[model samples]
Target: MSLNSTPQSVRVHIGLFGKRNAGKSSVVNAITNQEASIVSNIAGTTTDPVLRPIEILPIGPCVLIDTAGLDDIGELGKLRINKSLDVLDKTDIALLIVDSTIGIEKEDLSLIKKFNDKKIPHILILNKIDKVSDKDILLSKSKKLVKCPIICISALNRIGIAELKQCIIDNIKEENTDFRLVSDFIDENDFIVLVIPIDKAAPKGRLILPQQQVIRDILDTGAMAIITKETTLKETLANLNSKPTLIITDSQAFEQVSKDTPIDIPLTSFSILFARQKGDLSELVKGAYSINNLKDGDKILIAEGCTHHRQKDDIGTYKIPKWLKERTKKDLIFEFTSGITFTEDVAKYSLIIHCGACMMNRAAMVSRIEKAKELNVPIVNYGILIAYLKGVLDRSLEPIKAKELLSVD
Candidate 1:
């Protein structure tokens, strides 16, 4: 993680998926102009998905993911196939590599269908074109098979590589642009206070990624960022010449911070801010209402984006469940998942509560939300759930332009 480099989560995630010995790894190495993955003649050389972050002319900072072959065999091969499919959840764009000599196979068609189902923009790459004699016939057959931008290239000889890169850039540009994090909330010279709690869960001697990113965004907007712990929030406010424009706190300290902060000043939590940045704010806010509908034996899923060393009073595993039990007075069943593992069987749970996805990209978060929507299961995040439990959900969301999302009593 370099200070000058962009984070992998924020970069455009480009996944390369195809069958065994389709030259997927070779294509990745060609595009990056580096040996990003193992290039072996043996089948299933890439057992796991490999992520390489690089900067190109049109795409800027992008993460290139080379995944295992789709046509792998046996039990271990099935596991590899599953892993390759999982990469689709975070892929903003895809490259389906086909060995020109072998032409398009059934497995390749299946990959195209998945790309269409996920609505992920993809390019069908005809790799090792030099090995094929009748290029025109192969091109014609491929066009009829999959209706996507198809490019012919020789990964070993570097033929058509430049055009392939430009095609990728064009598709990514057409997909979507970057969204604002906090610039929309503050104007130039406005003062924004961030109430960060210094507890055991807090990383030693430094702020977390969300806090750092918020401060950077505030500075980028020419606004002032006043950072203080929840313990010193009152004194910090007292010493200020005038009221701060807004106050943002950690979700764990929402109850105390909401009490100390004035009613007129807008207040929110870091998780809420991030929900708007990386996920759907309104949808998550609406999901908070599910808390009231929880039955005695209902099941809840607590999902975290990153896996960190847990402290005894960890907020996700301990505090949130305890708070929900007390607030709803239900003997709820809790299931937990951390890192990139998200269950596809979303209907089993009555509700899904996710952590602020600071470690995940927007594509990944949106994929999770879409899965929940398809299963008709309500999903909320840590901040909104905490605010709802604390009976200050509306007030905490006042700082954002999503007031219409709050439920009317």
Candidate 2:
């Protein structure tokens, strides 16, 4: 990834949803001025969700997701429909395209109900307006059903697309600028040490996403960041003229970094910082305590945000499970999921151990955490879980002021 290019995780996710052949693909092409999706007269042409990243002026970077029609049929069609619906979990803004010729159907209403139920900001669009003689009827019918802005557009002719873009910009709730990885916790001119290990599993010629983002945040706060390897961490600290404000390291080096650093200076890991930035810190802290309640044969789900080639000693599949068994001294069953494939039936799992989620947007990560909470399942991220297993969870959370959240009792 280029430093200038916007990361997909930070972009606004706008999803196009409705019944088949409702001009969803046409709307995508018209708005983007490119054949981003395949438009077809045949229903169910789009078998899966299509994602296109485009920079919309005023709205900044945004991702448009064109999904399969909801009104599909047959066994295979049902699977496609579920995939489209699943897009809602990460959808920041939704565009419901209704064919004006066909008017509103039960499926469209059901989609609207889901948009409302999820509290997702959305716009109701009546496409193929050129075919319909009476546009008022299309507008009136939808207005009665949904309490949202309704616009009529002819996607083929590129009409009303500018207005649609403006509506999307308007509906976008301003992000919390105050929220950051570590910048919010430190002040300008403060020295922050980042201990990154270049291991066999590390990506070639680049730092991972979480490390890159944290460095950027530190620079944004006008703070100084000193990068070093875990092997040279002790020497690097001794060389510093003054004590640094905080020391952040990769979770895999938590044991050594915590041991090498002085007790007065604060300490934490990159994954723990991301857990607070991407998901709920307090909930994850509480979930860490639940590790004590594990028993023999308890089923645990190990979930990752993105899929990658697994090394011999992968962190999620190999290291975490091993440490967990040793810590609890129990025979626990583990299931693994990677890259946007989290199971909805979360009740079956006794616990959910997730990755740092640097590859996923905050909305998607929060949705998973919320779903687990709704199912009464405990969810903890890789950093917090590893910190607890290392017997330094309290010290790891002290820098972020999250140690108080450990009072789950």
Candidate 3:
């Protein structure tokens, strides 16, 4: 990942969805103007979701996800279909492609229902319009069945691709573009101190995603960021002539940083900042309260947004679980999941502990949090849970004092 490039987590996730042989791949290729997804006459050519990040006109950075057909057959096909549908969790805008020659089918209608159920803004794309006679008839039937914008295009000939792109731009909600990591509250020219630990677990010679993103957000706001390791945090503060606005540190170094920083100065962690930016801060804080209710034999799910090489004491796999067990003093059953693989069957787990989600988009993180809420399962992220364990949950959250959402008192 280049520092100049947009991170996938911050880009608008546009998903192309439809049944097998519905020209989903064709729509993707046509819209991107590149061979982003393999297009073929064979059904289910796209078995897994292919995500390509590109800058679209007016919309800026966007991720187009081409998924497998929903109407697949056989046992293996079922799994492929499941994988394709999982893309819905992170999809900001859905592009439902229908073969105009065949018209809308049961599968397409079912997909529309899903789009409505998820409340995801979607556009119905009628592909292969050149092949179909009486395009108006197909359009009439589709408009009657699906209550959304419809556009006809011949992906093979690149006809109406421009209109489709315009439709996508039109459906982009304001909420999708208004989110900021930490720029909304901070002012320009303010000095922000970032304590980044360069340990073995840290990526060699580069900062982590959350750290990089926070610095970028600060710089975008015209604020200055003073970067330092935990070992030099005290000296960095002493050398500064003016008081910094706030101090943000990694969750792993929360205790030591808290001890070094003054009580009057605001302090927080990168993970906690992401809780408000990427995930649900209020819901996560409530979940942190549930940590005290853990009993023996309870099943807990520890989920990380991205997968990485594990050290002897990885934060997600080792430190978090160890701290949780020691704090609760219970024989809890732990289930771990990393990357984009989040178990939909969350009822089996008493609690869901998620990472900071620097690698995931807000849509994906919100989807997971919503799922847990629907099942009445408490879900907290790594930073919040760590603060709870360190007995500084309230102090760690002081930087973002969202009193309406968090009842830290």
Candidate 4:
């Protein structure tokens, strides 16, 4: 609840995964120095993934995810493992806690394979080391997984706490130095007009996270943000001392913004920034062409990154669906799912339209896109679709490498 918790918990998601009674809860408590999870002999007590935001010396600010035991039994146990696997989607660094007494497990191997498939970097924690006589043997088994850094720790005794923190710090991937959010798009100190139209779909009395983030990012780069509604966009530009550096607008109002902003100044949308920031921009740009492939009566899935109650005219549910139907001139069958509910079942639809995903880490958003690709389904986001419909997708996506957009046609 304190501001100090924000830095460590806001950026990274450290997921603790292992079989039942494998010291997952113990490790969580040890790292956080709190009895965050109930340590128990009873299996499957942690029904869902328990999320605790904590700051550690090594891992910085991150969310500690304690998953239900993967080895749970019965119908309830099945639900537990499913929940654990679902937690994998948000995991930035995975700590595979293995009980030294158990040595290795089928559940451990399966969890490792899943992490490997997702390219998630992980380490092995040989927990309850106080109970094991031969620590080397358990570590040897862990090395077979991915040259996993195996640490001997006694959560009961608080031994190796510093060592575990160091291991976590070693694995955290700091943001790349080469990446520039606003500077990459325009020169330094450039003034950019931001068109945020207030509508019924807009969150009541507050700007959405992506818009706020983009505004902050622009200011962070020393650029000026001239925020206004689409209605005032034309007049605001007229009053500026010079042509504003560029224009960024919501995908929902891209058409109006593009028309109001004169030609020559680069124009794009917040959704495009997300395509680059959180999701795969290149693939989505290419997928934009597929919108033309849609026929009347085809099905499309508009998925939101995080679940929240929608206003009367929610962008994903109301505006996008209606826009798609109008653009295609087809009675398109539209289905809506919010949060991390996407699955292999989406193969039945003609297309999948995702949100800007301001709330999700870049990795998880890309992973969802990869799964959609594996199913041979075309998945685009709300921004990309709006850009495509407005006929400015290329202009919006100009920052991406040319070769990446070569597949756009």
Q: Give the winner by TM-score.
A: 3
Per-model TM-score versus the true fold: 0.94, 0.93, 0.95, 0.90
Better of 3 and 4 by lDDT: 3
Model 3 lDDT, residue 179, Cα: 54
User: What tens digits encode model 2's per-residue C-alpha lDDT throughout 1-409?
Assistant: 3423768787788999999999999999999898878888998888899988887777677888999999999999999999999999888889999999888899988988998888788899999999988887777777888898888899999999999999988887665122378887789999999999999999999999889999999999999999999999999999999999999999999999999999998999999999887878889988888999999989999999999999979999999999999889999999999999999789999999999998887778888999999988999999999999998998988876643343344
TM-score of 1: 0.94
**Pairs with backbone N, CA or C atoms under 3 Å apart (clashes), candidate 2:** none
Score each candidate by Cα lDDT.
0.88, 0.89, 0.88, 0.78
Across 252-289, the per-residue lDDT of candidate 3 in tens digits comes to 98889989999988888899999988867989999999
Per-residue lDDT over 1-409 for candidate 1, one digit per residue giving the tens place of the 0 to 100 score: 4523777777788999999899989998898898878899999999999988877655567888999999999999999999999999999899999999999999999889999999999999999999989999999999899999999999989899999988988887433346457777689999999999888778899999889888888899999999999999999999999999999999988999999999988999888888887867778987899788899999999999999998777888899999999989999999999999988779999999999998888889999999998888999999899999888888987777543444333
Model 3: runs farther than 4 Å from truth? 1-5, 402-409
Ranking by lDDT: 2, 1, 3, 4
Model 2 lDDT-worst window of ten: 400-409
Quote the lDDT for 164 in model 4.
89
| lDDT, residue 227, model 3 | 95
As a whole number from 0 to 100, the lDDT of residue 146 in candidate 1 is: 92
- Model 2 stretches astray by more than 4 angstroms: 1-5, 175-179, 402-409
Error of 1 at 347 (Å): 1.5
For model 4, the stretches where C-alpha displacement exceeds 4 angstroms are 1-10, 56-60, 144-146, 173-188, 399-409
Q: What is the model-wide C-alpha lDDT for candidate 2?
A: 0.89
